[model samples]
Target: MSQSQLVELDEAAVLGHAGQALAHVYFPTDCLISLLTHRVQPRSFEVGQLGYEGMLGAAAALGVSASAFDAVVTGAGRAWQIELPHLRALTRASRSLTLLMTRFLYFELSQMGALAACAHFHTLEQRLARFLLMSVDRLRVADLKITHEALSLILGVRRASVTLAAGAFQEQGWIQYSRGHMLVLSRAGLLQVVCACYRQDLSTYDQVMLGSTAAQ
Candidate 1:
């Protein structure tokens, strides 16, 4: 159960269900997963995201028996899996692991704060820009092989809206979309188009995870 291997999951694959105790943690190498809160009305919104920079089961480390959100694989990539017992033992034995987990927790909190603010104040275009930049940064790739439908799920927007926004981004030469894949043409340009929430989240991650590491 403590194998150090990478695995890929398809879209909508349940990493874990809501209210279910986590048995294993996932460390994404290039994959991205969304933490969503599902309501009785079937409305779900992304509360958090995981990528190569972080792990998925930090809640179990904090002694939480069940998660409030549903963890779903949004993109296909490699992820390292570790059983909960192994994870806890490793965390206790390694100060570096403890620090990494602590920093990631702080980053997640900051992301939640940013999401709240963005939902209330930022326009759709600005929010979309921030979302794209974040996805690109996490994947560490210029091209994102995701459809507007998947993006709508991640962004908690209507499919039509995502399509329109993507069209606008393409027309501005900020991004190029072909067959469910989006290519960032100009990172700087996209940053300019995004709101302050993106930078705020990045700063939090840099301060906590990277420590003295320079922010880029």
Candidate 2:
């Protein structure tokens, strides 16, 4: 922990490119990092997210050196970063730390699976709601500095689709959007609009990561 340094992440900053070797692990204090899976250049979708509640480079901590997805900073804020080798050495020195990291890795994989299923089976509105809800929960801010174009990239949809859904949300007084900013007006309304997968994702994290932390 003492070796870790506090760093500020700018929005859209690429932390680690896909298939590259990871050099550091980041634990966000308020930032949001998206793990993007790519099909082609400029065509990628978010598979997982890390924030204050989670750490990037779980695979590295678990002994995998290569990154499977690109890690991009979605929300600009601060985080604690440590060298990969240093983190791995600390894990080797502590059994409880190893267990906690193992559980976090499981939680991350579970989220990816759940989100993939949600993308295939759920409506765009529901998925959008889920994304916004998750973003706010992670960033602890209602006014998100994002645009419809950015939302489309994250949700793997056309920009027009995101515009349509966001328009509807604004009409319903559930949110307000202008330029590149979006303010969530009603969490309850979003809860009603989001799919069951949101709750399931939260439950999985609570059971896996939180339970591990508690046991430790």
Candidate 3:
């Protein structure tokens, strides 16, 4: 087994390179990481997000050696690292941990399904609102350092569309944007504008992680 270490990552840092077998699993303590699918056009769409509630190298737990998504740090956070061998051993020995991680995996799959439907059926404005709500929930913070270009890639839309949607939000006083930073001003208003998928995903996470005691 390899030694356990705590790693601190800065924003936009690569947690795992594409096509590389995960050598270590990372349990995020204060950081948020995004798992994105890189495309031929050099575009990327976020497929999953990991925070203090989950670990980064989840594919390895399911017996997959390689990752399809590029794992990048979306926020500054701390992660406890354990080598692959140690992680495997721990998972084998602990049924509780295995069940807990399985629950997270199920939630992740549901989130992906929700995102796929959202991409197909929802408008850019609705999708953007949903994205903001999800980010706020994961970071538990109001301010987000993101740009229209970044949002465009994540939403699989044109930069112009992102700009327009963001403008609408700003005009309504739902958010304050300056430079590349966005501060959510009206959480309730944002939620009202977002589609139902956001709440559905949140409910799944709450039920899986916190049971009936989860916050609404």
Candidate 4:
């Protein structure tokens, strides 16, 4: 704890790339980190995300230094950071911390699987709803400072698609958007729009990580 430091992350800050060696791990306090795929040119998509509930660079605890995806700060805020070597040493010295990391890894895998299915089976509207709700949950803010262009890249869709869906959401009184800012008007309305994957992912996290902690 003494070795860790708090740092502010700027929006769209690239932390690490796929196959790159990680220098530090970050536990977000009020930020969102996205793990994106490596595609040709400017084409890439978010596979998973981390916020106050999770940490970046979990692979370090498993004796892995290379990153599996490109990590970027999508939401700007503060985070507690620890260098990779210090993290490795701490995990070696702490059995409980190691156990926790293993559990978190499991939860991440479960989320990735759920996301894959959700992408294939769910409609764009449902996916957008889930994304917005998840962001609200992580940032703990209803007013999101994001734009349709960014959403297109993150959700791997066309900007027009995001605009259409966002417009519909606005018309339904679930949210309000203008000039890149989106204010969630009714979470209950979004809850009705989102797919089952949203709740399933949360349930997996509670069972795999939170439930384990309670048991101990």
Candidate 5:
């Protein structure tokens, strides 16, 4: 814990470059980080998100030494970061830590798989709702300090798509959108709009990492 430093994540700041060394592990308190892929042309899309309930570098903790995607801060908030060497040292001294991280990596893979399907099959409106719900789950606020441009970038869609979808959401009274931010007005409404992917992801993480953290 002494080695951990809490820092504010600037939105869109790149934490991990693809194929680069995984130098640190991040434990989010209120921050949100997204795993992004830029392998395709034109834009990058999110593969998964990590927040207070999750940690970055679960793959590295499982012995993967490099990142496969770019890890970017999607929301500006504070998280505790510990250098990778320290994390490896901790694992060497603790069996429980190793098990806990292994379980987390399994849980992380499930999220990635679900998101892959969601991205490929779900409508933009449904996917946007799911993303909103996921972001709100880790923060203490109902308002998302983001813009349509950011959403378009995160979802790998055109900004016009985000604008049209957001308009529909605003018209339905599920959210309030302004110059560069959004406030969710109805949690139940957003839930109704989102797919089952959001709920499954949360449930799996809770089951896999909850209480198991105490063991670590």
Candidate 6:
């Protein structure tokens, strides 16, 4: 841990951009990183998210240096970062490190695919609930700070839709959302509204990342 540097990431800060070569791999402890992608129009749309459970830019160690999506700091906090060259050297020196990176990168790809499908097919409310639940799991906090505009950019939806979803969730006693602040009041209630994709993603993570036979 002493070798890893801790850095504070501000909200909406871009960590990786399209076609840009990655210099560092980030291991988020309390921060949240969202991978944004778009086609036809230049707009931010989230395709995947990472937190304490994962790392961003590990592909660089495998010779995939350029980023395909915009990796942004969505939930502001701290993360541990290692230089790409250093990580690559470490992986070369340690077979266990190489194996871990291979496993993590594979899991990250599956997570991205799942997120892309959920974003396209699921309704805004359902998608919102799923992401919100995922966020809470990563943050391990009951309260969240988010703007409707920011969520719109991430979810690829209109801010008005987020407004509606937030209101409805509030009415159901799921959260208390107002003025860019949201306090999750009922995790169980949110689980009820979120699509099956959320649970499936968790189960996959448990199987592949955690090596757990018990389902999530």
User: Which candidate's lDDT is highest?
Assistant: 2
lDDT of 5 by residue, 56-147 (tens): 99888667878988898888899999998888888878987888788988898888899988999999988999999999988767898898
lDDT of residue 90 for candidate 1: 77
Residues 88-205, candidate 3: write the lDDT tens digits: 7788898877777777878877877788788889888888898888787777788987778778777888899888899999999999998888899999889888999888887888
| Global Cα RMSD, each model | 2.8, 1.3, 3.1, 1.2, 1.9, 2.5
Residues 1-216, candidate 4, lDDT per residue (tens digit)? Answer: 888999999988889989889889999999999887774576677778788999998877568868888888888899999988988899999999899999998888788778877878899999999989998999999888888888887788889999999999999999999987899999999999899988997899899998989998
Off by over 4 Å in 2: 39-42
lDDT score for candidate 4 against the true structure:
0.88
lDDT of 1 by residue, 1-61 (tens): 3455667767668888888888888999988888877633545667788888888888676
- Candidate 2 lDDT, 97-157, residue by residue in tens: 8888888989999999988888899999999999999999999999998878778888888
Candidate scoring better on lDDT of 2 and 6: 2
- Give each model a TM-score: 0.90, 0.96, 0.88, 0.96, 0.94, 0.93
Angstrom error at residue 84, model 3: 2.4
Q: Return the clash pairs for model 5, or none.
A: none
Worst lDDT run of 10 residues, candidate 6, spans: 207-216
State each model's CA lDDT, in order: 0.81, 0.90, 0.80, 0.88, 0.87, 0.85
Q: Clash number for every model?
A: 0, 0, 1, 0, 0, 0
Please give the lDDT score for candidate 2.
0.90
Candidates 3 and 4 compared by TM-score, better number: 4
